[model samples]
Target: MPSKGVRVFTYIAVAGCSIELSVPKQTVVRNELNTFWNGDLEVDARNIDSLFNKKGRFSFKVLSNGRLVTEQWIDVNAITGNASGGTMDTIASTPSVFSPNNDNIIVTYGFYEAGQGHDVLPNQHQCYIAVAPNYANWQGKLAPPGSAQEGKPFNRLVLPSAHDVGMNSMQSSDSVLKKVGGAIATSLVGSHEAVAQITDSVSGPAISLVAPNIIFSLAITQKDSLDAMLQIGARYFEFRPAHCHKTILAAQALPDRLYFQHSAIPGMAYDQFLSDAVAFLLAHPAEIIVVQLRWDGVPAECARPSDQEQREYLDAALKQAQGQIVAGGLDDLRSSTIAQLRRNKKRLIMLVSVDSLSTYTDAGNATLNGDSIVAAFPKVLTAANERGKAFINIQCQATAANITEAVVYSVLDAGTTTSCIMATKAICDSKTLPWCRDNVLRTCDNNVLVVMMNDFIDGATADVAVQLSKQRLEQ
Candidate 1:
C-alpha cells in the first residue's frame, strides 16, 4: 500500500518463531508516528506458550528501501496487557526505546494469544507497529554550544513545563481532613457537589468524608517525579506552596511546614521538592530549570503564614540549591542563552509572586516577580501575544464531562478511581498533544515561551517542544 519506489520491512522474532513483514512507504508526516500494521500475526501454539511460559524477548528491525532504519529488543513481560487492545500511540511508551538515529521510525508490537477474546484478534495473535519521533536527551541535543539555539534568548525558546509540578503524590482523606478542619473541608466539598447529593444522609456522610480526597484526585496534574520530569526534557516547573496550619503541625508534632497544594489539599512537602530538584541539577550540569512559586489560594478559614515566616522558610529551602540558582534580574535572564547559563554553572531560575519578591531578594537570589510571566490556558493565547514577556500556555484538554465522570465513578467505586483518572488523562493528553502541534505551536510567533501540560506530563509534550524549538532555530 505504499507509494512507488518506497518500501518498509519489519522483521519480528518471538521466542523461536520469526516473521518478516514488508510495508511500502505512504506519506510520512513530521512529528507524527505512522502505524503501519494493526492486524494479527498467526503464531503456533508452542511459540505462543513459550512467549508466556518463559521470559522470552522479542526483537524487531525496521528497514526502508533495503536500508535498516531502527532495531530494538523488548522483554515479553514489558508488553502491558489490556483487554481493550494495546495503545497505538507511540508517545505513551518510554523515551529510551525511541530510535536516536531516526526520529520518524518506531516499531511497537503488542502480543495477544488466541484463547484471549480480544476484539481485535479473537482467534489470532495481534501485534501493532508504529513510527514516532525519537526524544532521548532532547534538551542536551538541542542546545549544545555553537548550536543555533545557543544564541537565542532563554525566554524565547519553546520549553516544556509542568503545571502544578508538585501534585504527583496521592492525598488521603485523613491527611486532607487534618490539613483543613472538617467544617472547612465539608464546605469545599459542598461547593463542588450538587446540593441534593450532599443532603442525602446515607451517602452524604461517606461523600463528605471522601470529598477532599476526590477533589485532590481531580487536581493532581503530574505523576512523574521531579528528576524524571527533567530527564524527559521539562525545563520549567510551576509549584503552588501553601503554609500548613500551626495547629495541625503542632497536633502532628511537626515543625513549621510548607506543603505543595492544589487549593487546600496538600501533596508533597516543599523542602522535599527542592532537594530532589537540586540533586538533579548537580548531576546534569548542562541542564537548566525554571521554578515558579506561587501561593495556592486557600479559603478564609485557612490562615496564611506571615511574610517573615515564609521568607525564612524559602531562604532555608533555596539555600540547598544555591549553587545552581541563577542570580540575575529579569532582563539579564531574558538575554542569556543556554550555553551562556551552562558556562556560568547557573542553571536554575527562581520566579516568585509579587508578595514573595522580598523573600527571594532576602535570600540573596536574583529572581523575577510574577509580573514578568503570564500563565494562561490555550483559550487565552490571543490575549497573551505580547512580546518580551514570558508566557506559560497550559495545554489542557480535559472537559467538564470527563472530570464529572471521574468524580462520579470515583464515588461509586473507589478502587477504580486511580485507573479512571489515568485513562481520562491519557485520552485528554492524546487530544492535547495533537492540538498543540497543529494549533498552538504551528501558530506560535515568539510570544509563547513555555508549553505546559497537565495530568502526568510525559515525553510526548517534550517532543512537541523540541520540534517547535528546532523549527524556530532553523528559521
Candidate 2:
C-alpha cells in the first residue's frame, strides 16, 4: 500500500442484482523514487484560512551521485506589483552551499502581507508536482522583476524526489470539491485558514526482490515456505467454511435439517448442481437439506438436458421421497430460476447466495458465450414443470474451480492386462460423455484404488465398477 495517497470508494455488487456494496480502493507505492534525487524542484504555496487563497513558490536542485547545485526562490505578490510587494515576515530564503545532506523539503508556512494580519488571504491559490531527472531546471523568476520563463539549470544525472506533498494536499481538497463541486460547492463559502495540502508520491529504486521462478530454491532453505495440503470435494453432509462440526451437530440434533454439496459454477449458472440438489430433496423424504455447490464465480457451461432426463430424475425422486426445493445465486440461476423451481409447490423457497452470481465485471465475455446459457434456464424450468417436481434455486455463486479443491476425482485403476484395456476404453468413452466433459479422469493401478476406494471389492477392476454402475442403472 502507498504510504501516502488518496482513497476512493468503488461499489462492487452481485451482477444483475440491485444490491450495492462498498470496497476500499488502494494503490501500491514505489519505494524508490526520483523526485528528490535530482537538484531541480518546484514548490507552490497556498493559504488555507482564506478560501484556501494565497500563492507562494520555491525551487531546489541536486546533482548526480548526491550533489547539490543552484537554488531559487520567488514571491507571488511581487509579480502583481501590488503595494504589498509580496513581503511576508514568515517567508525565509536559504541559498548557497552545494552538496547538502538534506534530501527532504518541508514548507511549514506561507507568505503573509503586512496589515493583512494573515487573516485576509489572497484569492489565487496554486500547487504543483513535476519531475525531470537532470533534464530541466526550475521556472519563473528567482528574485522577481522578470517573466515566468526561466531556462533549465545545472543538471547532469539523477532526478529530484517525485514526492510532491503540496500537490497531494490540493488533490485531497479537490476530491472533496468534486462531491460538492457544482451548485452545492458554489453555495458553500470557501474558508481561508492557512491550510497547506500536499500530494506525496514515492517510489523505491529498482532492486531485486524474491522472484517467482526462485520459489524452489527458497523452499529448500525456508522451512515455512511449504504449502499445506487441502482435501477437495469431500462430501459434507454438514459443512462450514472452517469446520463441519457445527453443521454435523445440526444434522444430529434436528435430523430433518439435511445438507448436501453439489458441484457449483460460480458467477454464472448452477442448474446442474441445482438439479442434483432438487433430486436429493425429493429422495430424502421430509428432509430439507441446504444444497450448496462449490460454484467458482464463473459462468455456466452445460447443455440443457432434455425433458426425458428431467422426468426420469424427478419422477424417481417423487416416487421415493417428498421434500421442497430452494435455489438462489444467479450462477445458481437468475431470478427466473426461482419462478421455475416454485412451479411445483408452495414449499420451495428460493434463496440466493451472496456471491453465486456476477455480471460482466467478473468473467467478462467468458461469463456468457451468448444468450445461449441464459436461454437454457427456461428449458430447465420447463423440464421440471413437466415432471410435477418442485425446484429450488440456492443463490450462492462461488468461483473456486481455479484450484483442485472443487471436486474430488478418484483415479480409476485396473487389475489384469485385459481389465486395464477395458478400463482404458470405458474411461476414454466417459470423457466424451456429456456428464464427464468438464470433469477430470485418469487411470491408475490397483494400489491407487486400494487407497482411494471406500467400497472396495477384493478383486474388482476399475472397468468392473463402471460396468456394474451401468448395469445397475439399466436394471
Candidate 3:
C-alpha cells in the first residue's frame, strides 16, 4: 500500500480572501455533449467586510494540451460573514473539440472580483483530465423526474455499495489484540482445547499475540473514508456495530460504547461513522444513500443491551443527524423514486434487523427489516435473487477464504508477505464492474439492485453504475 500522495492545493488572495481547489488527480471523460467534469471550490471572503454583498466571480476553464476546450463563469454575492462552497459540474468539452484521441486535458478554476481578469490567480491549480472512449459521472448522475427510468422502483436501480463500509482504518496494535484475544478466550475457553492451551501457554506467548494480527489483517475490507467513498459514487453502506473492547471486557451494557467492526476487530468509532454520513448527506442535495446496520461480533461474555436500550442509543445518534433520513415505512420507501426522495429533502434510508425495526420505528425514524432488503455473499446471488427482494446487496468480498489465506500466509511467511490490501485487490479486481456488468448484471434477473465492492473501491465502479442507469433510462 504505497501512498498516492497529496492532491490538494490552496491559494491565499489579498485581504484574507482565500480559494481552495479540490479535484481528482485524474478524471476520465468521454468527448460528448452534456458530459460534465466535477470538482469542488471553496471561497472565503469573510475577513473583509467591505466585500459583503459585493459580487465575485468563479471561473472554470478546461484545456486539452494547451488548447482551450471550454470556459464558464458563475457570479455570486459574497455573504456578510460566511464561507461558501459548491460542487462545480461544468461541461468539459463538446463533440466538435474533444475526442477519444485527445490527451493532457487540464481542468482548473479560480475566483476573483466580479470585474477582475482571469490572470488574477496563479497557474499551479490545474489537474489533468484523462480522455477515454467511454465516460460517466462516477460521483452522481441520478435519473431525474420525467425520464424513462423515473418510475422504476428501488429494486431495479443499479446502486454501488461498499462492503464493510466502516473498515477504512483497521489497525493491529497491542491494545487491539488484547481486546480481540479476550473476546475469543471468553467465548471458547471450555468448549475448545486450543483456546485453553493458548491461554495457558507462557512459553508461546508470541503465538497468542500474533494470532490477533492475522484476524485484523483479514478483517479490513475497505480503505477509503466514507466521504471519499461517497465522492466516488457508493450509494449504500453496511455498518456492523459491536461493543467496544473495554466495555465487552467489563461485561457492561453500555449502549453508546460501540464501534464499527469486521467480526471481532474494531475499526472506526460508531459516532464518527454517523457524523461522516450526516456531513455527506448535507453536502450533496441530489444524492440518496442507504445505510444498513447490523449487530455483529459481540462476545458471548458481554452483556447485550435490551431492545429498548438499543433503541434509545440509536435514537440519540439519529437526532444528531436529523432531517436527512427518509421518513416512511418499508412499503412506501420501496415504491418511491429517487427523484421523490431528493425532492422531499429526505435522502437517507436505514435498514435494520426485524427485531430492531420496532426500536427504530418508536423513535420516529424511517426503518425497514430484512424482509425489504436481502444481503447475499457473492456465491449465493442466484439464490438471493430468487427471493425477489426490493434491495439485494451482493457483497463481492469472500471473507472466510480471505481470512483463511491471510492466516496461512502469516504462519508460512512469518507475517512478512501477508497483506490485507493485496488479498482484497485480487478478489475485487476479479469481480470488477466491467466483469460484473457482463457476468452478474446481464446474467442475473432484474433483482440486482446494489453491487457492493470490497477494498480499494474508486470511481471506476461508479462509472459502470452510471452507464447501467443510463441504459435503463433508454430502455
Candidate 4:
C-alpha cells in the first residue's frame, strides 16, 4: 500500500463516479464507464495499520489536496504487509501491469469485487486504463436559425436536435437509486462487516450501474452544460423526464417531480431546464425553439396513461410555460405557418410523443420514469406541411454500439473509426440526419419532418446544429 506514490497528469473518462490523482509528471484517474466509483479512496495507502483499522476492516484513503477523492476497504485478515508486488509504474488511463506491494496494492479499478479475489475483474464493470490524452476544443459554435430560414413553413426546415440531453452528474443526488447505491457501496468501504451491503448494491445496474450496463452507457451522457448547449447553436432540446428517486420497498417513486433523465436514472430538474430555455428564447426572439418530449424513462404506472391523461398532463405543463410556447395543443398548432408563428412571437415549441401516457415521470425527487428508445434510428418520411401542428419527428432506436461510441473519448479526441465523429458520420450519411434535407429549402411546401440527432459532448452533433441552421445538408 506504499511506494513513491503515483504521479498525476490530466485524465478523462466517461463515468458516474470520478476521482483523479495529480503529481508533477504523472496522473492517475479512476473512472467507470459502466459502473460507479466507490469514491472510497482518493489518496495513496499510508502503510500504517492504524489508518485502516476501522471496525476490524482495513480501508485506505486516496486524497487530492487532502480532499477525499475516494477510499478502498478490504478484509482486515487478507493482507500481511509482507505481500508486495514490486515494479515501477506510470499513471495513465490505459491498462498497465505493475505491483505497488502484494499485501495491499490497488489493482483493478472501476469494477465490482470479484468473488474469490479483488485482482479478477467483474464482467459487468470495466475501466479502460490508458495514457490520458489531451483533447481539443470544438472548432466553433453554430449560428442560430434566422432570416434565410424564416418564412419557410416550420416543417420545411430541417431541425438539429440533441439526444438524451440530461445524462450529466449521475453521482450527485440528481439520480435516485444511483445515489443510494453509491452511498451503500461507498460507505462500507474497508468494513468487513458490511460485505453483504456491497454485494446487494453492485448486483443491479440501477443501484450499481443501471443494469444492462452497455459498454457505451457506463458514464452519464451529454457532456455540455445547459449554457454550453445553448451557446452551441442547439435550437432544439431533446429530453426524457423521470422521477428523481424511488423507495426501496414497493418500488414507489419519490416526489421530486419531473426531472431530465436517461430512462430511470435522473439528471437535471425538468423545470430548471425549462426555465433556462425560456430565458434564452426570451433573449433571442427571432430564434424558434423546440422541446421534443418522449417517453423512454417514465415510471410503470405513468408510462401507459389512458387516452386523455398523458396529453392533458403535457398540455398543463406547456400551458404553464406561457411565454415559452405557442397557445393551444397540437390541434391548434397542426397548421400554423412559420411566418405566422414567428410574427406571433411563438418561439418555443413542444414536440411531445405521438401517444400520451406521460412518457417520462417516475417517482423520486423528479424522476422521468421513461425509456431510451434511442432517437437516432433512421426512417424515410414525406412532408405533411398542412398537418398544421408545428412539431417534429424523432426516429428513436439505435444500436448499442453506435450509442456507446458517441460518449467515449473519441467524441472529443481524434482516434480510430470507433470515435464519435466517425459514428456520427455513419449516421449522418445514412438516411437519418438528412431525412428532411431533400426539401428543407422549400418553405410551406410540404411540412413533415423526421428530425433526429446523435448523442453528446462534441463532433458532428455540434456541426449538425450549424449544418441545419445554415440549410447546408452537405454531410
Candidate 5:
C-alpha cells in the first residue's frame, strides 16, 4: 500500500508469491468512463491532471501462492525517479504509470478523454481501487427487498399497503425509476436537474449515503473499518430527496464530526454514559440529540403475552408518561383503549407504533396478523376524534394509515418485507377477521399517521423532528 504519489517500481519476493516490474514503451492510460489520458507520454507540466509525454513502458506479473496472477503495466519516459509513494511513481518530466501493488488490489485501466489531445485525469485515473483488506475471503450476501428475487435479501423496503393498493395509486402517478434511451448513457452525465425531476416525481422513503469511509477508518480500527464499506452498494447513497450531509448537520446544529458504535454495554459504564448524554441534551436544549440503546442483560425466555396482557403493559407505560392511554386486546382498540386515551388527551397524547394484527415479524416471527393490527389502529383515531389529542398510528403498513416513507426504508433495509406482507395479508384476506371486511387498504385522514417505527434509528427520526420543529416554529 502506498500514498497517492509517484514511486519507483520495487519487487519483494514472497516464497509463494512474487511480483516483477518493467517499463514497456508506448502504453496508453485511460479512466473508467473510457476517457483518454496521456495518449503519448510527452513530458509536460501544463496538463498536471493529464498524462504527460513520458516515454517508456513498465509492466508486472504477480503470482500468489504459486498461482498465476493478473498482470499490469505502466508507460513512462526515461524516468528519473522522484520519491515514489503508495500507488504512484513520479517521473521528472513524463507520464507516470503505476504498477500493481497487491493481488487483492484491482485496477481497471481505461482511456481518459482529452478535448482534442491526451491529458492526465487525476481523479479517476490514479488510485481508482476499492481495497478490501480481507476481501479475498469475504463473500457478498444477497441484498434484501430491493433486489429482483424473493427470500434473497434486497436493498429496498416493502410495505403491506404499498403491495395492496400502492400499485394502483402508482399506476396513475409517475415512476421514479425512469427509463433512459440507449443514446444517452455514453454521451451525457445525465443532467443534475433531470435526476431531480425523477426524485421529485416519486414520494417515498429516500436513501442517502450515511457516513464517510475515510473518517471511519481514522476513528475505528481494522476490525470495524470494513463494516461501512460492505454496506455501500446495499444501502442507498443518500437519505431524503433534498437532504444531504450538510443540510442534516445544519438542522441538527451539531459539531462537524460524530461517531457511532455497535454497542456500548459491558464495554463502557452504561448508566453513567446514559446519564452524561441526558445531561448534555438537557444542558443544550436547542441542540437535537441522538442516542443508541443496547441491552446487556442475560436474555430471558419470556413467552409472548396475549393481547390483554400487551395492552395492560402499554397502558401502564402511557400512564407513566402522564398521557392518555389505550388497551385493545384482540379486538377494536376503541373498545379497549380509546376511552382511556381520550381523557385529557389534548396536551400529552399517547400513540403506539405496535404491529396490531400482524401474523409475522419482519424476521419471520409467525405470531402477528394484519387484521388484528388494523383492529388496534383505530383506537388512536378514536382518541383523536373524541379529544383533540393527536393519536398517530405510526405503523409502517401502507394499507393501514398515516404511514411514512421512513418506515418503508426500514422494512426494506432490514430485509423483512416478505414477513411484513405475510403478516398483514393474513389479516387483510381473512374473511373471519373483524377488521378485514372490505379493508384491503384503508384511507387515512392526514392527521392520523402510520409512522415508520424503524425510521427513528436510521436518522429518519431527525427528519421528522426537524419537520415538527419547523412547523412549531412557524406557529
Candidate 6:
C-alpha cells in the first residue's frame, strides 16, 4: 500500500489490507510515488466525509531497482459514485499527511527486475488482505448493483459469481456422503480422481475424497459470509445443493433440507444463507443478488440407477431447494423482468439447473437448468457477442479427477498470474463479451455480464473478493 496514493476506507484509518512493501535503504519513497496518484496526495483521516473522496482509477506500481515489476489498480466507485455504502471505522481520529495517523503502508512487493526469471516468489509470509466495510455497515439487506440494474435482460450484466459460495468450511460433521456405486474412491484423490468421477458426473453420490480439516484449507472459497460478499460488490453466487450430512456407513443419513457444499464437505445451511440474503435485500431494497444452483453431490451404491431413477433423484433435490428458497421469500426471476422484480422488492434471482427437465420449464414457474459450465460459458459469450449483450459464465479454473479441492487448487496454482489475466482479457474482449474494447473494456448501452470461477479475482477469491469486485464491476 502506497502511503500517499492509497485511499484508506475504514475510518480512524488503518493501512489498506496489510501489505508488505520492500523499501530500499537509500530509496526515496516520496519522490517515487509522487507521480502515482495524479500530482498531489489529498488524503484525509480525521474527516470521514472525505475518506472516500477520491473518485476515479488509481494504480499501484512496484518499483525495484528503478523498474516496474508488478502493479495493482484500485477502483473506489465500483460500489457507487456517491459512496453511499461506505463508512469509517468507529475509532477516534488521529489524522496525518498520508493518512492522518500515517500508519506505515505495508506491501508485499517483488524485488527482481522485469526480465529476471523465477528467482523470487511473491513472499514467504503468505497472507491475504480483505478490508472490512466502513461507513457501509450491515443494513437489513445487502446491496449488489445487480439488483438496481433495471431493463437488462437476464444474464446481460457484468455479474461475477463465486464458484462455490458456501465452501467457507469443510466439516465432516456436516458431511453429506452416500455409498454411491461410483463415488470417486476416497483412495483415488487428486486430479486423476476428479477426471474419473466426471466421466460419470451424475452417477455417484458426491463424496469427499480428502478428510475434513485438510479440505477446509484446500477448498473453501469464502473467508467471510454472504453479507460480506455483497458489501464487497458481488451480486452473483454459485451454489451446489446437496442432501447433506451423509456420513460414512455406521448408519449414514441425509439432512432434512438441502445444504451448501464444495462436494462432500458442508458449510452453512442453505436456508440460513438465503435468509441472510433476504434480510439484506429487505433493508437495501435497490440491490439484488443472482444465485445459480444445481442439484449436486448425491452418493449411491455401486449400481447405476435407471434413467427414471436419475430423473426422480434430480427432481426431488430441485423441489427441495425450491421449497426452501420459496419459504425464504426470494423471487423466481424466471418469469419476472427487472422492473417487476424491483417493484416487488424481490431481489434474489435464481437460476436452477435440471438437465433435460422439460416438465419444470413447461410449468412456467422457473427456467431449465444450465449445461457443463465450461460448455455453457462459450454459448453465452457467443450470444453476448452476437446480441451485443450477454448473460455468461466464465469457467476458467481447472478441476481435477474427482472434483476434490486439492485437484482444483493444483490446476489454479499451476497457472501464472500473467496467464490468468490474459485469459480473463481474452474472454472479456469485445470479440466475445458485449463491451467496446479500447485500452480497457467498458459496457455499452446494451447489458453485459462476465461470471468467472477459479480466477474470479473480482469477489470470488476469499482473500480479496471485495477489492477485486470494486475493479471488476465497472469492467
Q: What are the Cα lDDT values of the candidates?
A: 0.46, 0.19, 0.42, 0.36, 0.23, 0.34
Ranked by lDDT from best down, the candidates are 1, 3, 4, 6, 5, 2
Question: On a 0 to 100 scale, what is the lDDT of residue 374 in model 4?
Answer: 19
The top-ranked prediction according to lDDT is 1
Clashes (backbone N, CA, C under 3 Å), per candidate, total 1, 74, 0, 74, 70, 46
Q: Of 2 and 3, which scores higher on TM-score? A: 3
Worst 10 residues of 6 by lDDT: 88-97
Candidate 1 residue-wise lDDT, 1-475, digit = tens: 1111111222221112122442221122212142122222222223334445332333445544344555443333212221222222221232223334443333332222222222211222233233333333465667776787776766556677766677665543256465544434444333455223433433545656655445544555555566666665677776766654444455552334677755555567777777677677776665677776676455443355566765675566557766555433344456676677777766766666522111111111111111111222233455334344455445452422133444444333332223233333433444445555566554555534555554455545666667777776655
- Please report, as a residue range, the 10-residue window in candidate 2 with the lowest summed lDDT: 222-231
- Segments of candidate 2 deviating more than 4 angstroms: 1-304, 322-357, 360-475
RMSD of 5: 26.0
Per-prediction RMSD in angstroms?
11.4, 33.0, 17.2, 15.2, 26.0, 15.3
Off by over 4 Å in 5: 1-269, 287-452, 472-475
**lDDT at position 1, candidate 6:** 21
Model 2 score (lDDT): 0.19
**Tens-digit lDDT track of model 5 for 259-307:** 1211100011222222333333233222111121212111121112344
lDDT, model 1, position 462: 66
Error of 6 at 313 (Å): 17
Model 2 — TM-score against the truth? 0.16
**Model 1 TM-score, 2 decimals:** 0.62
